[model samples]
Target: MMNKLYIGNLSPAVTAEDLRQLFGDRKLPLAGQVLLKSGYAFVDYPDQNWAIRAIETLSGKVELHGKIMEVDYSVSKKLRSRRIQIRNIPPHLQWEVLDGLLAQYGTVENVEQVNTDTETAVVNVTYATREEAKIAIEKLSGHQFENYSFKISYIPDEEFVGAIIGKEGLTIKNITKQTQSRVDIHRKENSGAAEKPVTIHATPEGTSEACRMILEIMQKEADETKLAEEIPLKILAHNGLVGRLIGKEGRNLKKIEHETGTKITISSLQDLSIYNPERTITVKGTVEACASAEIEIMKKLREAFENDMLAVNQQANLIPGLNLSALGIFSTGLSVLPPPAGPRGAPPAPPYHPFATHSGYFSSLYPPHQFSPFPHHHSYPEQEIVNLFIPTQAVGAIIGKKGAHIKQLARFAGASIKIAPAEGPDVSERMVIITGPPEAQFKAQGRIFGKLKEENFFNPKEEVKLEAHIRVPSSTAGRVIGKGGKTVNELQNLTSAEVIVPRDQTPDENEEVIVRIIGHFFASQTAQRKIREIVQQVKQQEQKYPQGVASQRSK
Candidate 1:
């Protein structure tokens, strides 16, 4: 398999394709698709030779987007594996502890405490693969167990033994399973149920683990079998007085004990495990007191648990922001919601006319204004109607779904805004007309501009290129362009700038009026700005300026 190299210091804007293009251009024979992670990428080269060359040639030499790249030969996978083995050893360990810890990383054939002829504990050792054993010996030579401690050695067994029989029969079975070793165990035990020595026959690395597993299983079963029972019961009663219910101390308690012939334990209130919170007392011994004690403990627990839960809930309620009543964001400053009105008592709401001039999202919050009884009444002279058309997409957002927008608008503009309805052919048209005192309309427009300013819809000082193109049919061009395009009657009447149509030999034949907008960044950029200003004005006019109402500008 090809080796993988981890590449780092990538710019956030860089993509996987970009990396591949860079390497491909440099003639690097990458073997597979580049893998990209959140902050880095990895590339695999077909051969170690290519990998080494790339490392030497490109290390600290490649540049990306003006930044120098960092590179090095990636560590071989085998070396990485060895590093993991040495670093994860558990602390304050023994043979068994180390075996369990290392087992998680990979198979640990056997972890044995080596002993000399005199049976003195020498060193605890382990192994992964047979080959790894040799690697271990060379790497761990003269190594100390701790800081400046005993020197230990990891000597590789010569042609590591393919078999290692354990202390008993169970040992070989567990080892066989753990290490996937197909080994046989020769039994040497008598009539006694205890397992005998077990022989594990497998590869060197496999034999040790098979033996380890067998030993662990047998040890567990033995522990379960050897057991003990606790003493039955012991009951101590109050001294003397056997007569209160037998009431008095021992008289009462002892009478019951005697009658039942079972010992009983009775103690004074101070001696009992019950205080004021647990005022009830009971004799605990024999079946009778045991049952009674259970009843008393249950009663006390219920009371304690209930009281604790209530206290916790109350503490949580006292925190400020957590309580709904403390916030004034949307709701009026009313604590309890008023009960729903009865059928006859509740008044009907004003009609909701979507296309009506002034209705907006927050309209319901304001008091209703009385419309003139006469259907056709005019309040202003000249009665000029200026139709401001906002994009249909912006209508809902500006109106805020409900009448909130229009209400806020009317309140600020000091005029009335009427939204034209959605009729069959004009469905896409969103027309808002302002009608009121002329001064109010002007004030409302300014207020709308201010609202758009707050919403970041306008950039008054931004400069942009502007261009306009007008075209006419070839036959009409003579009349439209005039001689030398000087007396261009059509262009002069329609727009401030000269209009041009390329006089190529073969012109586009479809010939219809074409108005092309080019280089006019300034004007086109102001489209949204101008629309937003108009929407804001409509909103202010729809708002009610009456007392006690708060005005909201879309933030």
Candidate 2:
């Protein structure tokens, strides 16, 4: 609803002043600078009424420098319609008299009266056709109506209603600042909904620029809405803690709502099936609000999970000769613990995970990539980002001949490989960021390791090995270690890879901890899979066995 007009089809010789004189001839005042473009120009009006009057008087009717130009509300930036505004009408002026005055020039369609701060009545008159509206402006200007003269202007009528302006009109403010325009978003007459039809009072160019920015913001919002719908705030939680979360008569849930400004809903118990034992607590709110609710929700679920683990811990020989606390990291991301000795050597039930039906939890949770048509080889094990440290001196060799070698390596492994900038000139090791699926990570890392060896960075007889890091949820870190370091030890035995979880290390902002796997290719890969599998089991564990312990615990 910008009070900006697009003066199009201008002759090449017409300057800003020429266009100004054209509007000036009709007593139309240019509010700001005229934005002159190649074949057209834009002119602003402080009063939307004048903008409308200009359109009515001159659009496709007037000539400038031998060119009949198009003059009207900026069709792209502002809403447009066939309406003329008559302002400052004395309250005593009868509707009949107003209708008579309007009918002399055009077919009167509708008159919408709006409340004014002053005692005078303001009516927006719509005509049956644009031609009639144009004629009405000419006949109506400076016409006497009792004690008040008709203050005439154009009423922009377009379809930018029912759109969000922004959180606190900041979006509108930003558009004006960025485009050097002034937008009237709070005019009482324009207030309809969050989608307030705004008019930017600036140079003609700034007005159009502001409109484009507004459209960009709108498109971004649309994309975000779609993305939000596709990936909802789905939090997987244990069923045992769900009651505590709800509290007595849903008081806890109400408290959470009050604290976080979010509405929380849990998956119904009746919908629970054996395949998916975990309860889903879906919280809905703004992003920051949802994050706050998650922190509170996760705190309660983590307590419940630990309590269940505590009960399981009390009953020793659960996994026979393994302490739950001793478990730690191992080669790659493997979590290794001998399955509970099942019924006198019947072999472990193939490590079934509630959420993962694939080759157990390890291959399912961390990997987002599906294998590429290779039956005998390992199926795609999701995408992984491994930061492998290499000697600083070997950087040139890897980058080689205008970056040809690294580019070739990336294509070969189908991974993104980049050497991070050195921290200082004397730094011993520089980080190489490798991003790809497990096979890609293995291939890229293998090449880097072999390259270092070939470059004689290591002794001739020494086996090439490197340390790789992977992040896991902080909750799963304990399971990676297991009770008394049992899992880490078992994974080393399982994969011949050295894996270590740093002690006294804090989880990152994402609530994840890094596990370092130091070993040759196969060993690290095996360990990572084993560890991720354990994480999957821990997260998707059925609480049926815990129900006995869970029920007996006092509130």
Candidate 3:
């Protein structure tokens, strides 16, 4: 049950004070002021019994300024249940006393204990029927049981269960972990029915946070599941925050597009609703690209939210028609909406293969990766390989005792990691061949660099720089080198990484040869991405015009 009632069919002559006088005459007190709209209004009735009475007595019964009034719950249908919660039961209260007290009003179908971190007890008491529960609430509420108060609150307990349990039960688990709340998805009760009632058990403080997270997850899944040619992600931000996201003359938006390889567009001003006041930001790209853009966009939004919070706090209404409670801000006397959190509660990453299945450039044999909601930290999930060289003496630290550290790194990165046999005794460097997707390569390489710095492999305050080698098709070597070595030089300048291609190198059995990259982790990663892009261009060129490629090769 909700306290906010929608009051409609009001005459233009009726003022908020007129409606207030009517409720006041009926001994009803409002939790908040009436939000007056055109010929209608919305007001929060603090108590459910009072709200029920207001609906019964006023809706289509009373005349306000010669117009019949309409009053009803603002919450959506079927969200309510035949359950009422009783909190603040003294710890010493016996079950017999509670049962007898509950029996006085209605038939007790079931009662579930709600876990809390306090001495006071709480329970979800489900009556035999909705009518019975209604009676129980009306009669037992504000009544003392065993000389103790049992504060009653109706629980609107269920929602769309699918969104809460995301890809492989990951989202609900995250809510459990992050909010310290346990979510029980009761799927068996109504196997074929769409509406599944889920239970969330948590302390009072964490309950709101968990509810907010579940709502967000549902909102996101609802937006992205539309049947479009390309799946486009739409983010709704307050109109006041959109300007900062786009930046001065759209620099921020442009930067995000270039960095993430996505196209972003904002909804037209004409679509702005006085009630919503939100602008829809449309981002189109691969899921990975959109994921990256989402992070950046949310960062900008959070910054604006923090700065605008002060101004919103000082004012009574931040957005004239917006509801602060709906935005998860319930601060007393202040109506401030916090920043939107990015898509969260993705599944834990897939486990790593200790041994490489597609070893040494054999990715064709491996199955395509399944798309899942996963964490992205400035890296993609496309399959890749990197041959990272570390100091020979430092290899012990990299391997750790009995190869434990390397195994841990592989697990964390979801990659198949291997250390190559040293070329000869006393060699200056040893090779660590990392086989995995792009994100794994990023993590494994990043950690290796960090470990080197931590172990004093580099001077204190010195950047941990290393050489990384990757193999590319011999035919694309010239394309990477370019005419007069222009492409490689540009890559070097752009990424601040050294790119070297030794001339007249014999192609290996796979018709591929080595391209060495030397720089810090970020620089090397950028250089590799650029070089691989050139390789892709050459491959596409060959596919389109084979004879032309042959002629160019002859030149």
Candidate 4:
């Protein structure tokens, strides 16, 4: 026994000064020294009496950081030196060979070869004195016997032993084969230590390799235990399009699962209510596998979205007098219709020009269509606009110190973004307006969403939900809502957002009705873009048939 007490379960914030103050408050005599660690500490006293008193008084009685401290007398480490356990001895090594090896260092009073399993054994060589055992350990700890290197260490905790052995001893067998080392975990016969000594028998290289393998396995087990307590990744997707993501008879989702080794399950249709048309998609796997699955899932969803957009565009094209140019549909320089034939024998409609004046005035509200649907490459940046409502508390994180973060974000996203002032003193949220092409919108809005998440605006276990508002002509609201709400339902399916055009709402000065979109950042942005397209279509229809519009207005 030593005149020192071990103090465990200490808070990291506890300092030497705090310890001294605590001792003073308790009226305990000063200790000789204090050795502090992350979550444990050691204190030396002037004599054994003080140490004993400290243990009696403080053990399980003192509290720090919500944990009761564990105090006990320090055990003398020197006592363990006499009992030397030689590990990682090649299984083929006869008992005579091991005996001869230990004989060189000291008189081996007792040599017990405890067979832990068929392929591994531990030899406990107890010398007559501690000096002999120490000498043997120092000289032969790293010595190579055949192809196995010796690994010598004190016993580990019982938990580590259970982890090493695994269920039905399968883990140890795998580790033995992988590291080419025989691992022997001794059973504890006394209460001196919570765990028995584990020894490895192998070549010097194999001994080190075995140690690494064991540590890695232990770490993996710990990580898995922690993850078991965490929530699975829940992705909200539109109820209608989730079928597309699942593929024809769940083939798409099955393929993603096979490739990524992750299990995915979507919420049942019964879970859907008027408030939440989106279904929750739960992904379960290790972090890396979950991330891979997310990528695959999103890829399938994007493809579905592109196809849906193409279908919608085709439908819009059939509406007589719909100006694709005014709607910025041909900004990608793709010809939706052949150019008009020149007067008389002139060359039939000169080759299409990208900068043709007929393309109409480009608006920042909607980005130019520089890329075709599923284009292989984007040569020029196209502009897009998105409006976000962020909690006021999280705005500082997005802005950073003196606007450094915001400036960097603008440059990185290649977009012009601004945060509007608070509407009033009571408002808890502010509007973040972002203008950029698709890539820019992705970067800028993604950063804003990420910033809010990092700042803990939403619980770590929950997905971040955001609201975005866009304005469209009141007349276009009918088309957006569609006949019997079919169009809005399709938009929600395509974007995975809750689209609400409040009924009988008064229009703004511009005769525009506000469409409220709510969902995760990506879903809300997608819904906004789709609604803008509908607004553009309505504008073109009004321009094409003024007489028909007037007649409808009169009616």
What ranges in model 2 sit over 4 Å off? 1-381, 542-555
Q: List pairs with backbone clashes in candidate 3.
A: none
Candidate 2: lDDT over CA atoms?
Answer: 0.56
Give lDDT tens digits, candidate 2, residues 275-359.
2234556666654665566556655654554554443233211222322112111111101110011011122111110010011
Query: For residues 1-555, what per-residue lDDT tens digits would candidate 4 score against the true structure?
Result: 113455667788888777777777876655344666667766655333354456546767888767788765433232223555555678888988888988998898777764443244556566765678768878998789778877553221133445567768999899889868767653533212322334555553564455445544544544543412222334545544578899889998999989988888886876543223345566666556654665566566546655655654443222222223332222221000000111111221112110000111111112223223432232324465567898888888888899998999899777898999888988888899888765566567666775665565875334567887777778778788887888889888876789998868999898988888888754665676667667666677788985665334211
TM-score of 4: 0.39
What's the distance in Å from true for residue 515, model 4?
1.2
Where model 3 places Cα greater than 4 Å from the true spot, the runs are 1-382, 552-555
Which ranges of candidate 4 are over 4 A from the true structure? 1-385, 437-439, 549-555
TM-score per candidate, chains pooled: 0.19, 0.31, 0.34, 0.39
Indicate which candidate wins on TM-score: 4
Candidate 3: residue 204 lDDT (0-100): 38
> Which scores greater on lDDT, model 2 or model 3?
3
Residue 151 lDDT, candidate 1, scale 0-100: 28
Q: After superposition, how far is residue 67 of candidate 3 from its true place, in Å?
A: 99
Deviation in angstroms for 310 in model 3? 29
Sorted on lDDT, best first, the list reads: 3, 4, 2, 1
Task: Assess the local accuracy of residue 497 in candidate 2 as a C-alpha lDDT between 0 and 100.
Answer: 80
Query: lDDT per prediction?
Result: 0.35, 0.56, 0.61, 0.57
Give one digit per residue, the lDDT tens place, for model 1 in 155-213.
Answer: 21211111223334354455557776665322211110011112333443454344334
